[model samples]
Target: MFFDGTLWRDDAMIREGLGQTTGARMGHMSMCGREGSIAAHQFVLGRKVYIHMNNTNPVLRGCMPDQVGAWVINRHYYQHSIPMTDAAYMSRVGDPALRRT
Candidate 1:
């Protein structure tokens, strides 16, 4: 597993308790669980795999030219879509009782 020791580096908790190695302390915890204690990385090692991804959108990390091209070709890759056709049909012919849906 990749141990990113710097993800929570210089965070508030580390500065407050651990004296601002950030989580740069000799023994710190994970950013989520223990609040940036470095020792947390110890458990992250070994056979287990840490995906090492953030909760944010991966696309924001800077997409490649080919990735953008493929996205243009296969628009469905982004499933976050609004069914305008269905909405229009409903607006014209749907029951008012079901409009609350």
Candidate 2:
């Protein structure tokens, strides 16, 4: 599993297996809308996912009508989709109403 320490690293694959350096904290997303975060998601490759997002993470807002939707619909690669409210995940995970027909 890759553990990227930078919030926006140029190339995460390079540091995928290397151990953390002396002082490295986890990455975080602080952009206002989802465009920037969504771009980062698309930049990565292979079985991607997100984690430890703040409640206000852009994914929560569903703001990037173009990019975020593209990721959810076409790419199927949720690179930065964590910190979701229980209801949001449940809605997608279990609720029939949330699924596409």
Candidate whose TM-score is highest: 2
* Local accuracy of candidate 1 as per-residue lDDT tens digits, 1-71: 53432234435344445344544354433444454434456466465322222223233248778855654
Error of 1 at 99 (Å): 2.3
Q: What is the C-alpha RMSD of each candidate to the true structure, in Å?
A: 13.2, 14.5
Candidate 1: where is the Cα deviation over 4 Å?
Answer: 1-68, 72-83
Residue 27's C-alpha lDDT in candidate 1?
48
Best by lDDT: 1
lDDT of 2 by residue, 1-101 (tens): 23222233322323443435311133344232353354546666786555333222334355567755544553233343443554466666665765433
- List lDDT for all candidates, in order: 0.45, 0.41
TM-score of each: 0.22, 0.24
Model 2 residue 81 distance off true place after TM-score fit, in angstroms: 20
**Model 2 residue pairs with clashes:** none
